[model samples]
Target: MNRQTLLGYVYAATGAALFSTKAIFIKLAYMERVDAPLMLALRMATSLPFFLGAVIWVVWKAKRDGKPLPPRRLWISAILAGCLGYYLSSLLDFEGLIYITAQLERLVLYTYPVMVLVIGWMFFGGRITWMSVLGSAVTYAGLLLVFLKALPEGGHDVVIGTVLVLGCALTFAIYQLLAKKFITVMGSLLFTGVALSASAVACIIHYIVVSGGVDFSASHRFYWLAFGCGIFATVLPSFLVNAGLSRVTAQSNAMISSISPIVTISLAVAVLGESFTIFDAIGSAMVIAGIAIFAVADQKRAPAKRETLPVEIEAA
Candidate 1:
């Protein structure tokens, strides 16, 4: 590979690995008795300023280039997309993690691309080849293995958690589909900055309204965890992934990101003392393999049909 390509791989892998740590930090914070809203709020609070800075920078650059500003409608759409993807989807994921292992959560959320494909086919006249179906089936079969294995151990909570995470995946898929146009017009960086900042504000408002006040009474460790989530997991990985995209093909970036769930599984085992059974092993492998197949098929899709669709889902 050329130097740029090599650097792209490094950036993508590092970003994926870092983003994978989000669940571990979240699980640890939960051990300290932090609720989902507060945790989400704190994380958004911590990350808000950086995203705001990005927004300012993008605006300045746009003006410097004599580009017209995005319309109010596009800004609203971006904000809505951010709220759906980061705020709602993340809230569900966080809540689900309370009941399910991080490994399981990651695996379940990994199916969002499949969800996107299905949604596209259903509503947007997108074609579904046999390869996509096979890949999706295999992916779900693997998830079933993991779910069945954990069902006995976690019982009702596992079911509930799985459902919640499913909701997260679905919402995120919708967000990806709907946000494409806004991302195109406003540019990814600007749209992302505006959306994420709006989501952060929404999260803070939700926390205050739900809890009757914003509580910052958590332990120091919780603060550190929040910082890790906000900066390392959320903000840093975003830029790293964007950087990787600049240097590498989207296909290569997707392949590199396949390591994400594996990284999360390893961290959960090491840090959270979660078990890794034969079922978990086989199931995780299947999930990754299935997604790989799906990604390949997606890339092979008609270029015209692919124009309106996003290639990958954003990380939580």
Candidate 2:
């Protein structure tokens, strides 16, 4: 791989590693009976201060350089991105985790890429290649295996959890695609700041509505961990991924970042003492293989096609 590609791979790998810690932290907080909305509110509240600081610094630097501030349209986009992408998506994810195994939860959540592709095809006239179809099939087959295994052991809650996780995945996918539209105009720091702030506001509202009031004293440790999760897993990884995307193709980034599931499952098994059955292993492998195939096929089909015209020809 070229230097830029290598850099992107490193950044993406870092993001994936950080992201893998999300489930572990959530599980830690959940063990204390911290409601999902409360935990989410704490996370966003903690991260908001840091995100705002970054925004201030960025804006000041731009002004120092005599650059114009991002326009109102970009800010509006940022608010929507934050509310839906950060707040709603994360709330659903944590809520879903309450009902599913950590591994299963991660597996379902990672389906965002598939959702992105499908949404693109439906909304933007993008073509869905045969390989994408096959990859999606394989991925879903893996998910089905896990679902079937859980159904017998988990009873009714398993189905509910699965549906919740699927919703989380869909919402997250929408966040990604919609955020892309504003990234260029607002830039990453500004976009993230606005979105995260908006998400924080939404989370606060949800927490109040669900619990009747904010209860900060319920679990100090849980809140602290949730705050750490927001920083380490959410903000830091997001920054890394955005930086990486600037240097590499989405396919390469996706392939490297797919390691997140492996990390999450391993942590679940080792730290959480959760057992990984044979079927789980097989299904996980299938999911990884499907993602690999999808990324490789996409790269092959869209190989960096760049052309340069002669100066004389360009004048015409």
Candidate 3:
């Protein structure tokens, strides 16, 4: 591979690893009894300035190049993508985290690749091949094993958490579908910047409406955790992966990102003192296997009419 491609792979892998840390930080924030809305608000609030700065720069660059401003429709897409991808999905994930282990949460959330495939087939009239179907089946079978095993110990919490995170994955898949178009039109940086800005605004508004207002007197430790998540998990990894994706194929990015669940699971076990198990190993293997299968299936499928989902994976 060329240096640029190799660098892209490295960047993608590193960003994915960083994205895996997002859950860990959020889980840490929750340990402080920070409400899900409040935590999300803090994260988005902390990151908003950065996104705003980037948006301004993008617009300035466009003006310098004498390019027209992005249309209103594009802005609308950004807003919707932000709300669907980050604000709502994040809120659901956080709520679920309150009830479940981070390991399970990561594994569940990692299924978005599959979600993308299925949702595309269902909504967009995209064709699904047997390989993709089998890949998804293997993935879910592993998920079922891990999930069922989780059930015996956590009981209702596991089910509730799984449903919530599943909601997160589903909604994010929707965002990916929607934003893919916006990205093509607006470019990754502009689309991502605008979407993040809108998501931050939505997060702030949602928090106010739902919780009445922010509690400024919360523990400083929580702020640190939220800040870490805002930068390390949200902003940094996102742009990093976006940059890397610009240099590499989506397949390469996806394959590199497949390591994220393992990263999250290992971190959860080592840092959070979560238990590790044979079932966890088996299930995680299956999830990875499924993703590998999906990637291969995607590659082998007829390409002329595939309607082009980008190789760009979300670092959100």
Candidate 4:
């Protein structure tokens, strides 16, 4: 593989691995008596500084080079991206985890690539290849296996959690679809930075309005855990994924991101004392194999091209 392609894989893999820890961190924070809202607020608050600095540096560099700023409308689009990706999706995911195992949550969230594929096909005139369909079938079948295995123990909570997680996956898919356009205009770092900062603001506002105000009286250990989520799980992975997206097609990156659930499940077993069954192993294997097949299948989809009008400039 060329250097950029290889680096794209590396970045996507690393970002996925890091993102897997988000559930673990949120679960850990809960174990320390930190509610999801409080944990999210603190995590986003801690992450804001780094993203803000990135925005400043990029803007300053653009000015120094005598480049004109992007259209002001792009900033509004960035805020909307944050609302879809960071704020709403994460809110649903975190709240869902209150009633579900980390393993099941990861499995449900991994359904997003299928969502992306289908949504793109249905709404954007993208073609749906048989290989993609087969891959999605295999992936969902595996998830069903895992879910059925866990269902006997989880009862009603499982149903509620699944619905919430499905919402999370849907919103996340929407964000990814939009981002494929936004990133081309605003650039990844600037787009990511602006989106992150906007999400941070939205999070802070939501926390205050919902919880009355921020509470800073948590224990030091909880503080450390929250910081870990902000830095390791949030900031680092966001940049890596953006970088990967810049270098590779979203299809390739989606395949590379299959590593995330695998890592999360393994870590859940090791660290959180979650059960690991034969179903887990088989299901995980199926999901990975499906992603592999999908990646290869996408390579054959290059020739059915059709002429299309340019995207509207207002998309910026």
Candidate 5:
């Protein structure tokens, strides 16, 4: 590979690894007696200023280039998309994590690409090939393998957590679908700034409504973890992945991101003391393999179509 391509792969892999740490951070915070709403609020509040600064930078750059800003309607739509993907989806994922292992959560969320394909084929006139179908089936089967093993010990919590994470994956897929046009029009930097800012604001409002006010009584470790989640997992990884996307094809980026689940599982076992069994080994492999197959097939199927930057991957 050329220098630029190698750099892109490094950026993509690094971003994916950072993204994998989000679940670990969330789980760590939960161990500090932090509730989902409070943790989500803190994470987003910490991230808000960075995204707002990005917005300012984007606007200033556009003006310097004599380019007009996107339409007001697009701004509204981008905010709505952000709320769906980050606010609602993240809330569900956080709540779900309370009941499940981070490894399971990451594995489950790994199926979002399949959900994206199915949603597109069903509602957006996108085509699905037999390979895609086979891939999706294999992916779910692997999820079932891991999920079923969790049931006897985890009981109802596993089911609830799986459902919630699945919801997160679905909403995230929808966000990806909707945000494509906005990204195409507004550009990734501007759209991301607007959307993330909107989501952060929504998270703050939700926190106030749910908790009556922002509680700052948490341990220092909690704050540090939240800061790490916001800066490392949320913000830095975003620009890194976007930079990678600029230098590489979307297909290559997607393929490189397959490392995400593995990273999460490793962190879960090492940091959280979660168990990793032979079933987890087999199941995780299947999920990764299935996603790889699906992603390759989906990309080949629409080789001529315009590729939308998968910016949503970094939002996790």
Candidate 6:
């Protein structure tokens, strides 16, 4: 690989590694009796200052360099995207984790790429080729295998947890689509900052209402771990993924990301002492294969295209 491609792989790998810690931290906080809302609220709130400061610095530097800020409309999209993508998805994800194992949760949530394809075809007028359909079917089949394996051991509550986590996945898919739309106009730094800020505010409000107040006095270690989640998992991974996109095709990125479930499963077994059965391994393989097929099919059906329309035509 060339220097750029190597950098892309590094960035993508970094993002995946950072993201792998998410379930670990969530499980950790849960062990501390920190409820989902409280944990998510704290994570967002703690990360806010850094995000805001970064936004200010980024905006200032842009202005100093005579770059134009995104219009008011893009800011509105950013806020909505942040609310739906970060706040709603995270709330559901954390709650679902209470009922499901981290490995299972990641498996269900990893269905977002398939969700993205469906959403794109349905809403954005994107075409769905035969390969896309076949890929999606295989992907869901793998998901079904994973779900079946989990069900016999998970009891009735697993069904509810699965639905909630799937909801989180859907919401995140919407967030990705919306972010793709606005990222160019708003610029990644400013856009991510604003979205994260909005999410943090909403989470804080929800935390207050749910808990009757905020208190981190019980354990500073958990709070610090939450901060680490924000920095390592959220912030750093996000930066790396964006940086990686400059060097690699989305297809390549998707292929590399298919390894995330395996990483999560292994980590769960190692760190959380969760059992890893043969079925778990088989299910994980199926899921990764499904995603790889989907991505490959997607690339074949719809190679990336450059827009010929003027900026105004493209603007919403």
User: Whose lDDT is greatest here?
Assistant: 5
lDDT of 4 at 299: 58
Candidate 4 lDDT, 1-316, residue by residue in tens: 8998789789878888888898888888889874777777788989999989989998999999999877888889888887778788778888888888998888888777678788888887777889999988998898888888888899888888888888888887777778767767777778778887888888778888888866556878888988998888888887777677667776667667778888999889898999999998898888777766776676577632221111110010
Which wins on TM-score, candidate 3 or candidate 6? 3
Candidate 4 local Cα displacement, residue 193, angstroms? 0.8
The TM-score, computed over Cα atoms with residue i paired to residue i, of candidate 2 is 0.91
Per-residue CA lDDT of model 3 for 116-228, tens digit only, reads 89899889777788999998998999999899989989999999989999999998888888777777778777777787888888888888888766654468899999899
TM-score of each: 0.95, 0.91, 0.95, 0.90, 0.97, 0.92
Task: Tell me the deviation in Å of residue 313 in model 1.
Answer: 6.6
lDDT of candidates 1 onward, in order: 0.85, 0.76, 0.82, 0.78, 0.88, 0.76
The regions of model 1 sitting more than 4 angstroms off are: 302-315
Better of 1 and 5 by lDDT: 5
TM-score of decoy 6:
0.92
Q: Give per-residue CA lDDT, model 6, range 95-165, as digits (tens).
A: 88898888888888888888978898789887877777777777778778777888888887789888988
Taking the tens digit of each residue's C-alpha lDDT, what string does model 2 give over 1-316?
Answer: 7997688789878877888888888888888874888777777777778778878888999999999998887888788867777677777788877888889988887666788789988986666889988888888889889889888898887888888878877877777777765766777667777777777888888989988866656577887788878888777777777677777766667788779889999999998887799999988988887888787777877775321100000000
Candidate 4 stretches with Cα past 4 Å from truth are 1-8, 245-250, 302-316
Output candidate 4 Cα RMSD: 4.7
Between candidates 1 and 3, the lDDT winner:
1
